[model samples]
Target chain A: MTRFFSLLILLAVSLPAHAAFNIFATVPEWGALAQEVGGDKVSVYTATHGLQDPHRIEAKPSLIARARTAQLVVATGADLEIGWLPLVVRESGNAAIQFGRPGYFEAARFVSMLEIPPVLDRTLGDVHAAGNPHIQTDPRNLLKVGEALARRMVELDPANATAYVANYQAFAERLRTALVRWEKQAAPLRGVPVLVQHKAFPYLQNWLGLKETGTLEPKPGLEPTSSWLAGIVAQQTAQPARMVLRAAYQHAAPSLWIAERTGIPVVVLPFTIGGTPEATNLFSLYDDTINRLLRAL
Target chain B: MRTTLTAALAAVLCFAPSADAANDAALAEIRAQVKQMKESYEQRIAALESRLADAEKTAAKAEATAVQVATAPPPAAPAAAMSAFNPEISVILQGQYKNMKDIPERGITGFWPANGHSHGDDHSAEQRGFSIDHSELVFTAGIDPYWRGNLTLGIQDNEVEVEEAWFQSLAIGHGLGLKGGRFRSGIGYLNDKHPHAWDFADAPLMYQVLFGSHASYTQDGAQLKWVAPSKLFVEIGLEAGRGSTYPGTDENANGANAGAAYVKFGGDVGVANSWLAGLSYLQTSAKDREAEFEDVNGLAAQGLFDGTTKTWIADFVWKWAPDGNPSDRNFKLQGEYFRRTEKGELDCLDEEGVGNACDPAMSGATVLSNYDTRQSGWYLQGVYQFTPNWRAGLRYDRLDSGRRDFGVNANNLLVADYRPQRATVMADYSWSEFARMRLQYAQDRSMQGVTDNQVTLQYIMSMGSHGAHKF
Candidate 1:
């Protein structure tokens, strides 16, 4: 009996320590960003991946199970994930990551907005009524996300506050220098008329001084109709566009059709971190996007 | 062409001179006029170029500003994680496959006759088909800090239906506030929430018989629930909708006038562990108008004159764990007992296979009678996590049906029918938080000479923007 008790004690001692923090992120972009800030101090999981369309994700029992264990959660707010993420959180009953908790992080909190529709309606095809949720396309917003993430990490683990601040500073400096070079390289694209697959490139176009001649999607989130494509083709023929921009994850068929009809080069841009194999981190996402657009032009 | 020729002629005349002195004076005037025209043209071109340059610069600045602003931190927190006013939508797809053997020839009858048959016979490959068991898309939005609403649309077996749609106010402190729509009645344990929470993918025998194939426990109604200062909870609801038909008689054979009202009360007890017990009462009026049918020549008069039936259900759930850790081993025991009785007039026949002599005025007369049915079942479930990524569960359920009058009798006669008991066992292995593979076997010994068995294997996977798990 004494030996049995000793064995039990040994087994209990041998077990691994429980994870310190349980972090849930809405998408891979937030997951990767959280990892950069949390390092080994936290365990993070992403609800969506780069290969899938963010707008059409399906909820499953497994996702609910993950949410049940999270202590901290990060998500892209506005109406981007309004289609799915809230149900999982409420069902999970994770009080720590519930609304108003310190562990909850909304990445959109730090970014300024653009193209906010004065009037909103569902007839225009699943618009984010609050504006666009694709804020990660711009590099400067990422800098702000990094800073906000650092603050949250510090609050969660105050002992590592100095390290978090230092890391954030280093990341911001490197990003700022890179942005200057990217802006210079992309300067020649000023005033160039372009077509886009979705509203995902407003920030990019803003940065490069490019004109958005039109979008392939007749309306936001709506599939293109044959008539709409024909009209676009006719318009582009009469007044040519220099380039057509498409996200790496978008269906290539429509963009391909537009390119084939207009004789314009189609450039696939990485819309988020790790959106493409070459774009692994935040800085690399911008690098790959600017280089790809410049090459195509 | 004429205008150009006249202008050229006029210019030559203006430059021509008659004498040397006159020519010099005219030439000076011509030179002065030419220089002034040249200066004016130069000024206009410079002004236009400056305007163009300014426009380009402004556009560049605007573009730069947009980028800077986009990258900047938002003035307010994102509504996705913390805002109570935003709505969240979710879609789920689930499929299952089951193999049945030795199914009865009479088919498995239930509340609804259309769902009673197994689609195959005993000798054949019994049951083989894929079912989209749960194709649900749910939308939920928080109205404020203390109020929320939920709407769920589901499709199963090619039929579209509404599963649960209601609004709840959390600001009522210990009190619950609700309004509008149909939701699960707080009668039994399994009737109140999603079927995924059950140990097995399918519902228990008691649940199927009492509520029908998809369950009719939810109806268009309103309810108010309150949690007492003690651990007790009380709920009262009134509903108007279709009712379940089972045990050979369509409880609500008529189409429109079937409605019910119910009240339930339960409470939690125990110190270290926890246990809950609840009792519910329901009264519904039958909708069938064929209660007076008579076949004296065939001796098959099984009609009942009673239109109202009263049902009572008692249920309890007990949970135990040494450390109260879900990841570790734990035990749960749950059960429910239901008794239903109706007062009506039933046909009476003599033992000589002949109808008793009766006056014309007495034919199909109403008589006081009683129809009683009882059903009870329970399950003991346990879960043990051998590792973080692997866990195992075991569950067993048994159901017994008391004697009851069925529409048809043995040998195509008319009398009471006896349904035997049933038992089921399930074993499941969860591979990860997002994936699980389960195997279940169930047996039905309801008929004396007929016995049936079913084996099912199921796998589930999920993808997309899911929230975090609660501890």
Candidate 2:
């Protein structure tokens, strides 16, 4: 053990400085976006995977060590990570990622948010004060954030400014063209009544023009009481939703339970990048989401 | 309306151009008056719209502010949430109901007896009844950009004692961290953790023998740690403490009487398995540490030992989880071995009226004896989390009295080599991240002559903001 530690210390001391700028993203989508925008000039480290919930995490020291060396920190922000991110960044002691710095980029700030509560109360249940932070569900919002992130990259790494601008323009154009095609293809899904697992899919519902009738989780983080589930079942009996929708990452029990009772097919969408095998990147993320919804129908 | 007026004006122009120029001037004045009225109304409407927009913006900002405050649990200071300087406060509550065949006479085998701060006085001996255990209130916040301060006050039966108070540097660069004031020493695996964080209702037998009932290596001290920049987690830490707790006393820590150093490494075995191992060394000096013993007359006497103490510890932990997610199911196996050696002088004195024997240097009647002893202990524990909210664990502990030698004394006392062992089984359920209840059963043999069959039920609850547990 002594010999191993000694060698490790020597290697750490003797290693050359890395040429790649290191970026630490709070979630996977931003990590994917960073990879797309910064092809060879950066290395990205995502703090969370698709399956793990991002609200809370075990903040290990190795994560702090990684943050300590990070040049930029891209996060969903708007308190989506309010429980863990502030503590991690504070512990990292990295001045570059401190709030108000150029390297501190919040993707939510670049996009218009939803669900800004009209009145503040604990009764609201796990609501984000800065508005709903699950903005990546909407492809339009991701494009806006992508543009902002590319500009931030240029500000942080001025030498790669032209490359970043070109990358952003190309990504923006591709997304716009895809957006028109997706909207036209998804016209059939318009006005389709859908029951949701949680409010995580409201932006997606809005994008696809689906009418969300109710949610399995009446309040965030609260288990569905049988009484609450009964009310949804009654509604489904009257109006009869075409499908029950949920994110691939969420537990399927509640959605499956509702589907079994109501005979509504349950559809699992890729909520973010890499949520499913085919949802590998930004474009594929939406493609798989639409395909899954159509398959369920 | 405008076209008719224009045609009327055109007919009048054809018929009345020969009429008076004053009539045309009067018509122009009327048109100017109508135009001015319209412009005034348009400006007033624009002003009203601007005011409405500003009101909406202000309302939205207010809602955001209110919602942010509502997100956190309400604090004593209503303005505390927005105030950047408000300290983060957290409270931990622990309660337990214990049942046992017998509670021993408050002393650990092969070690010193209770000295006020023992398991006997607080929750240990209070069996067959519900007792509020050592709960704590913690306050922490950043002192400045460069340093963060923390204080934990232990609360037990209306008595509040300072458990730990320290300040740590945030920007010490080069994988280096520096801590000052009093903090838990980086010792064996479980030494630094509080009882609230323990897997069982009580500590292991090995910890009871090595330290007091509270298995803490905390003291007034300073520590420096370094993390190697390697794929594997490698860390080295060293501490210098005022030896004012168990294993040493306040009297012994006149200077830097305690010191420790440790090296640890951890890495993943596969996608779902990981392991960590560490080696630690500690040395301290104690003056007049007291324990109970039988004199030649078979009466209880106080034995004060002054000596140099040295200890070595090795710890290992292995964890496995399905799909790298511990929420559904996981297994953890951890073990630690400790060996301690001491060279000291024991001064035995009668209770109440010791006849100046309390001061060994002042009286010849003081039974001054020189002794050298070696003792070792080890424990292994395994826990399996069957679901997100339920877990079961089993632990075994062994202690060995390695070697003992005593000098010639007036009372003529000697202790035999003996190995003591204990086993414990526990199950716990967490209602949420903030609350947990545990049921435990143990067969302890830490006492020389008695076997203790102990059962305990415990609940630990945390309220307010708390930092994440370290891995």
Candidate 3:
């Protein structure tokens, strides 16, 4: 029995040596990015899936359990996770991944934010004080955030610093090549007027130079009503948009309703990794996004 | 260069006199001009070459530093980048208009009064027509690297009360947490939650019978909780407190008067459903716990009991949302069951000595007897969110009076075999996350055979900080 116990202990200690670094990602995009940069040196646990709303997540016990064992916690800060992340971090009881620690990395801090409200008010409907946190929509932001994220990983796990750097460089090189190709393919989408279901695509619009004609939601985070849809339809009659864009997680009812009246196409974009079957990884996410938009055009 | 050429021109002009002299002077002037131009070009070339050398040196220095930065790891981010300790302050404004029967001495029938001896105006009493509920002021902030503190003050008309004040450990590793001070005990699912988070305007009958009407089982003490490192989501916690509330009286004695322990487990089922269940136990002691009761002759009297009480609670909750997006639609089902057992001694005193049924031999004297009783109750509630800003809920609760043995003091009090129950339904509409208005109706039969139909219109508005609720 003693030998058996020793054997079990040995197995437990030896198993984690290869993939010893544990990363707790608040969203699927960060988890996918971390895996791309960390390679096989880290094991990641994503707290929310692609279909789940990041802002409305509950601080479940399962998330706390995953956070307790994590060496690093990567999130899209800027109050994008203001509703749940604070509670989860506090309940985890893991000091290493607390705010301002080396193990805490926020992707939004490394990227240039957009849609900063001129005034701070809750009356604006859940407006983030730090601006829009959907930085992953633009592939170029990924390169910048990935570089900083790699440095954070190195600081937390210095033993594998070289590997982290090499991995980031490799990822940057691949993504840079893909960015050139995606830009060339999406050049025709430039200056094309489109409607959005939610205010979730500023970075995407900025990258592709797509003209945002209007939003289905009357305000940010508010559901679209029939009157709002009718207003969009009336506006489309004068300055007609070509297509309506919606995220994979959003309900397609409103976008489809607008499309039906205006005779415009409805394009669904994988807003993050694993949002669609083809968007299973970082590169495929943008590839699938551009392909859908091009098809719609 | 220009100056030198001008000097040569002036010398040539000064020497010119006759035609032959002029020709010779002009040729010499041309030759001197050419010589001056050659020296001027040499000086300009030297100056340009020196400037080019300086530019090259600076470029080399910049390139060398760039190389150094590229080879070395970047400096660590500042430790205080996100550690600005700004306290989260918030206030909750709540008011309601209630329409119900006028019953000043309202008490649950067939059960011991929960308000005990210190009762004046019950805190949960809803005056007819309109009244402002408690306005709550909350402050929470990280004290340092190791602790987080929270303070909440409840304000009513001309009165202020400290509802909760506690400090929780932040840096306690190993999935362990420690909390100290006056805070609500985590004995039942809804016990620790504030009133604003409740779906209905009123509490369940089970809770009202166990504690007091609309009262929470709070304690002033310390608690420790541990979470297991497992995929199934297991947690265990224990608390020790000075139970100076209902079901327990302040004895002013040393040591812990109340103790509680609980174990909880939860997990998600696929992508659309999640569940959590827990079992909790509480043990407390009471000295001279007082309650008003009626005798066989229907006269007013009081009963004081000294006893040890134990309670057990089991709770469960299940939530469902399509694709895990609750903004569109969601549903939650929650329920809790509790059983309590008490053993003690009861002293019955005749007030005003006007009751003839208080045992003629024991007139003007306290009737002492051995007392023991057992009681149980359960409640189930469900809340449905059909839209992003609207929710409706229904709750049903029932309590069993169980059995009571009063020994020799049985004739001094009235004991009946009765079960009290209530059914409530409410709907609330939210303008946003910070504001909500609700309308509720309830059929309450908790007061013996008297059924009171109640309706309430309520509004709750939060200002400043946004709080994330726990599941």
Candidate 4:
């Protein structure tokens, strides 16, 4: 019996702990940021990939197990992950990463949020009262969130504080230099009236100063009906938009149909890191977004 | 007047030169004082200008640092802090219209009637026409940094019952969790899930046979679960409780009458597929358990059982969604099988005199001292979500009577050599995450020689703060 217990202990202690700090990010964007900020001091596990909608991903058992040993959890918390994050944390039983703890970090609180609703109601079709949670579309928000995430990492793993701070400084320097170039290249997109597939691009519009003409979705989350598309087609005869924009994860059919009818160009932006082949990192994500919009223009 | 004025001007001119000597000296003194004051004022102005320049330089440097990085720590969003102390509450309103035969005394064919089946008083069985099902009121909240509490009340018609009220530990390290109170035992896959979360409108024939009127095996208990610190999901749980529900009767005993242990393993096959499988065991003892069954002559008889029951359950589930985004489409397949054994003494209280209802030698009650039986049941189901709002499911259930040994009163009740089975199909549509409507049909052969065709239409709407569901 003693030998059996010793073997059990051996098995339990033999779990794979590859990194000094383990972080679970809810999306690829935050995962990329955590990697850049923590360098080799941390290991990140992204819950959802670029092809999946972060709002609707399942809380699979694998995710729960991943969360059980996580040292920190980074999320875009403007009610974006309200559906699944709470359940994951409760099931994980990891008190370090629960809400209000030092190890839990929300990115949205660092930057100024846009599109805050005046009324809170589900009749508006899944409106986030806290504002749009897709803040990663703009490079400025990424820098801000990265700075805060670095501080959180240092707080959790103080032994690696100097390494984390140094890495964040290097990353912030590169991002700031790239931001100036992206803004200048995207100057032509300013004041360009554009149609969007959904209300997912308010921060992008705010950053690039793109004018939103209409949305393909009838409401925030509802799919567009044929009649709504017909009405948009009729309106385009009088006043036409320069382009229709959509994210890489969205279905191409809606924006493609609109582009076909209006004869406008369809611009598919890699909304986050690893969303497309070209968008492999934080800087490339913005580069690919600007290149697409400029192509469309 | 001109001659007088010229004379006065000449006299004043004569005195002007004499007064100019004194005035010149006074003017020189006033000029010296003015120059001293001007020098002091210029010195102060130069000092103030330098200080302003220094302040501007520091301000500019601070602004530059702010532009380079976020200097101030980000404050948490005020909206995330809920201050009302109001627990998360959700109310589920459910109603169903069932169309089926009106068989008053409904019982599974081969399996012995469990508790709450006497005269068909089982609440698990649905009504004939339109009826309000068990609507649920759930409240959950964190008690403190270390614990959380949950309460769920099940209401039907004018009756209200506490279905689950438990408190769970929050800060137990080592991937360990503790829960205590009245809760549904986590023995099988579907046992812990509420009715609204079920794909079909009714329980399977296997569950109906084993648990009788109860939708799940519930007990007032305490549970301890541990999750292994591995990449692959592995969990082990143990439970002890007062077995006062189905299969075990409340005898006002001091110690625990039931205990359970389970272990689950799961992992992701790929980005699209995930699966979990588990095995569980439960044991309980009962005293004077009452049940109603038909004798060999087809007459209703009452039986009292006193003994121990042991059950083993194995469950498995697989879920698939393309790229792990279920909003577009998804599919789930689940199944569970249970084998049970009972060893006890069965005493027949009523001995009908007609035909060969008990031994002719017995009087009022017939006692079978060494009664031993073994029974098993299994169910499999598959649900496919073809669209974001529509889903369809099909399920099949079967039960085996297995072996039976009646010691003395063998002539009173003959062992049934039959297998009860059922097949069900359902389609449901959801307007949103909160509301769903389902239509289901089942060909039930649970009762002996009765192939009852059942159709049901049900609606479920959840309002208020509904939390996320478990896997």
Candidate 5:
């Protein structure tokens, strides 16, 4: 029995106590930012891949077990992950990383939000009460989130504070320059009329100064009714749009269906890092997004 | 005015000084009034210009928004914080339509103890046709930084029972967790979940034989679980429960009536497959447990049995989903095997006292018989989610009691070699995550010479806040 217990102890002692801390991010954008800001000071893991919808991924046990040992959890709060993240954190049983704890970081908390609902009801078809949670679509919001993440990493792993700060500063400077280049390169997209599959591109459109003509899904998260699709088709026929915009991770059928009938080109933008091959990091995410819009134009 | 001064050269000498002073003062008053008017007019002009500029800016914004709705500016709405620290509440309503050739005389096999059945009424299955299968009310919340709590109430007919109410420790470090209260034991994969969460409309026959119609493995107890830090998922759990319900009665002066221990390990295969395997052991001491059975003469016979029961179980599950997203296509295969052994004495006497040592005999005598029996059962099921919102599954259940002894029938015990087997097929469609409809057909051979053909239609609807499912 004593020997068996010793074996059990050996198994329990297998927890990784490496020099780098583990950071668990709920989405790809947060993971990319963590990697950029933390550099080698932390190892980052993304809970949901780019192809999967962040709102609908399953709270798998593998994720919970990984979260159990996470030194920090980065998520885009404002109830974006209301469907799964709460239970994942609760089941992780790690008090240090629960909501309102030092190890928990929400990117949306650092940036201003959009599409806030005055009155919230489920009848509105998945309206986020706090605001639209797709804040990372705008490059400016990414910079703000990166700064906050840098401070959090310092607090969690103070030994690497200097490295984290240096990395964050370098990344922030590069992002600032990229934002200017993107605005200049995407000038032709300004005031351009386009149709979107869903209302998820508010922040992206806001920055690019694009005008929204119609939406495939009349209501968020709800399949478009026949009548609503008819209405969009008729409306777009009366006033033609330049293109149909959709994210690389979004379903292609909706945008393609409209594009086929109206002859409007469809543009699939890389909404986050890893969403497309060209969008390999935070800086490239904007580059690929603007290039896709220009191609469609 | 100069002519007036000339009106009287002589009078002007005295009046000219006063008139000139009055004229100067009047001029000063006129100048001040003119300055005030000019200032007011300039302020008005400035206000009008600013208003015009604001109107132009707003029109430009509206036009910009109208150009491309793809990036259309959102209508300004004040944001209201909806975050609440209050406990999340959810209700699950399950209703089913069932048709069976005949109702079983007993809920479980004869060897199974009586307490496994419902406490208040033994005829819970009497209702036929359309019936409210169950109504479950659930509440979950974090009590504080150090703990969390969950309460589930199951309401059936006019009776309400506290199905589960437990508090779990959250501050325990090193992947250790502790839970205490009345809860379902973590012995098997399906045992820890409520009926509404089940893939099929009803429990498998093996689960019914080992537990009951409703899961009877739940009791007032404390459990401790440890998650190993291995690359793969590995966990060990132990539970101590008051076995007052089933094969074991309330504890005596000796100690608690029951004890249980289990260990589970899980790992992933490549990127699309995952599997879990577990082993469990349970032991309980019964003071006086009663169950009804058929005698050798085919007559109803009820008796009290006292013994120590031991059960061992092994379970395995494997799931494959392309891209790890079950939304499209997935397949799950699960199986569990259990063996139970009971040894003690049974009293078949219809007497005034409840004692296992006493037996029934003619001519004013009593005899006690050895209640030694060994039984084993197993179930295997496979479910395929061929498409979104659609799933089909098939399950097989079997049990064998090949060995049996009653001490040469010393107490006139009626022992027979009885085996039961069943096969079930089910298909379900879910409109959303909160609503589901299921159709199931089952052929049950639970009784010795009976094959019950049963069909059921079930709907489970959940509303309000609900937690995500555990992997």
Candidate 6:
């Protein structure tokens, strides 16, 4: 028994060490961005999946354990995961990846935000109230986030800095080419008036030069009401909006109601990573949203 | 009709010409023209009056439309119908079953009849019972942008009681202002919140022995907590009454008196990650009667005798959540330890058996003793979250009564009634923020020959107020 124990111990010590930094991204979009920059030098995990609502996720113990071992942590801060993420990080006890530390990254820092609310109040149905947290819908914002991740990855793992910088340059050039193509395709869509289920596509609206006529929701965080729907219908009837747009995961009732009342085709756009089968990566998420808008218009 | 005739006469003069101008030769032509103009004016005035009447009618119609829209019934849609009755009420129900065996005479089982039989079969194994540990109804009202109130009533073991009734003033920037009756003391880790927040259904051995199962540490008090200039939280509280039958205690001893003054200081540190540490102190006198009884009947009446004593305690807590995020499935651990020393007298029996000799068979009389029993106890416990919903915990407790020689009496058969040592291991699965189930097995071995195996299964839920407080 003693000899067998010794042999087992020797086998454990003989295993090859994994030097790659372990990273935990708050959402899948950040996870894809980390993978783009880190390549094989980092292993990444995302707390929220494609189909889940990122705002209301319950903090489970498993997430804390993952954060404990992580050398780097990335999140969409602006209170996107405010309900649960802060408590998880506090419990993990890994000071290296804590907020403001070198290993901590907030993707919002890299992108210029839209819909930065001048006033914030919870009475408005849990508004992000700071700024729009859906900056990923803009291709320019995605490139900025990609570059920030690349810079942070190089800072944390200096040995792999060259590879990370090279990867980011290639990704940035490809994104620049895609941006030109998308702008050409979206040129005809400029100044188009549209209605959406939620304010999740402000960046996309800016990118395509679309005017957001209004939202179907009565308030930011609240569900739609009939009176609110009636008011929307009255407004839409007078102004005659072109299309009703909705995130794939948002409740379909309000969008369908607006579509029925206004005689406008409802366009279900993938707003984030894993929102649609084709929108698995950050680039595809914006591409799918633009294509859907073009097809609907 | 007469009013219309008068209004026509006025329109002819107002629109045609003045009376002096009408008599001139040009006015004579004007008079023929005036007669024609008067006739024309009458027709025009009649048309203008009709148009004015129609305008009044239209104005009334618009007012009626406004009222109709204002008082219109909501649209008959499925979603709208459900939204009208916003269900803001939430309930949390908890149940527990405890199976305990070989209970020691000084342990929790000693407070109640271990078995159904009061005197017979002292060695018989006790059967378990199902208890409604906590069934609570909570009502929360969002009065406005700056005010909210929460009232919670709990039913435990078929007894109804109020757990929390407080109104919060959230408008105070960075300051949490609250006022109400029956609030837990801001002392120990487990004292500030409900039992559902505990890893184990039963409190730690130290808490049970020191404060009993309910921990009458709550008082009718007023407290003000403010964020200091340095960002740490400083709370100061004063209570006018003593501990009561509920979870918190009245600071006063006898009637209404100045109970006690308590102050706590703590803060959260780290930009994203955070650590919380607190220090607290409480000083209160036990009821004069309780102290006098210990001196007279407990010590003097028996051969063992002593003077009166007082009670005081000091506590500290430190917790760190390194990542400062609650949703991440990562390594999270929290541990706390508390120590308390209580001073009091214990009465003993005389050598002649005059003091402790009740019925010789029923009462175990002892010989002379003269001393005060200074008792002390401490416990250490910790929990680590394996996932967001699952956690495991371990605890160890030891208590020592200062009266070591009191148990040495051959005639005193109640030697089993002394301080004991215990250890517990608990594992729980929290299914959601409001619901969880726990399974715990504890082993208790006393200084006497008794040993117990206790297994408890508890299901807990919470609603209405804010969720559990993190360490």
> How well does chain B match by TM-score in each candidate?
0.61, 0.78, 0.81, 0.81, 0.78, 0.60
Per model, how many backbone clashes are there?
21, 0, 0, 0, 6, 58
lDDT of 3 by residue, A1-297 (tens): 223322332332233322479999999989988998899999999988878777788877777778878889999998888888888787776677888778789998877778877787777777887788887898877866787787788666755666776787678767766776887889999899999998889889988889999999888887788998999999997888999999988877899999889999999888998778899889899999999999998
Q: Can you write out model 6's per-residue Cα lDDT over A154-188, one digit (the tens) per residue?
A: 66776666677667766666666677677777787
| Candidate 6 residue spans exceeding 4 A from truth | A1-297, B1-88, B102-129, B142-148, B156-158, B168-178, B232-240, B245-273, B288-323, B330-355, B358-373, B403-419, B462-470
Interface RMSD of each: 29.0, 22.7, 23.8, 27.3, 26.2, 30.2
Task: Put down candidate 4 lDDT per residue, B1-471, tens digits, no spaces.
Answer: 212222322332242224477688898999999998767656654554454345446544543654432233344355645555889899999888889998977778777776443454626345788888788999999999888899999987678999999998887645666788999888888888888888899887777777766658886877766677778988776677888877888868665777777778888998999898999888888888877656777775667788988889999999999877787789999999999999999886564554346544446646565678899999999999987779999999999988877677566775677899999999999877778999999999988799999999999999877778768
TM-scores vs. true structure, each candidate: 0.51, 0.80, 0.85, 0.86, 0.82, 0.47
Model 1, A1-297: lDDT tens digits are 223322332332233424567678887778877777777777887876564556644333345456655667888776676655665555443445666667678887667776766665545655665567887877777776777777777666655555555566656666667888888888888888998988888877777788998988887876666798888888886767898888876667788998888788999887876568888877787788888888877
TM-score of chain A of 2: 0.92
For lDDT, the strongest prediction is 3
Worst 10 residues of 2 chain A by lDDT: A1-10
List where candidate 5 sits over 4 angstroms from the true fold.
A1-18, A213-219, A222-235, A238-246, A250-255, B1-83, B104-126, B252-255, B351-367, B408-416
Q: What is each candidate's DockQ, to 2 decimals?
A: 0.03, 0.08, 0.22, 0.24, 0.10, 0.02
- How closely does chain A match the true chain A in each prediction, as TM-score? 0.89, 0.92, 0.93, 0.93, 0.93, 0.91
In candidate 2, stretches whose alpha carbon ends up further than 4 angstroms from where it belongs are: A1-17, A60-65, A78-133, A211-214, A217-219, A222-235, B1-84, B114-120, B124-127, B251-255, B295-298, B353-364, B409-416
Computed on alpha carbons, the lDDT of every model, listed in order, comes to 0.57, 0.73, 0.80, 0.79, 0.73, 0.57
- Candidate 3: residue B380 Cα off by (Å): 1.0
Best by TM-score: 4
In terms of lDDT, which candidate is stronger, 3 or 6?
A: 3
> Among all windows of ten consecutive residues in candidate 3 chain B, which has the lowest summed lDDT?
B67-76
lDDT of model 1, residue A40: 72
Tens digits of per-residue lDDT, candidate 4, A192-293, equal: 998898787888888888988898888777767789888888888677889998887777788899888889999988888767889998888988999999
Docking class of 1: incorrect
How many angstroms is residue B190 displaced in model 1 relative to the true structure, after the best TM-score fit?
13
Off by over 4 Å in 3: A1-19, B1-85, B118-125, B356-364
TM-score for candidate 5, residues paired by index: 0.82
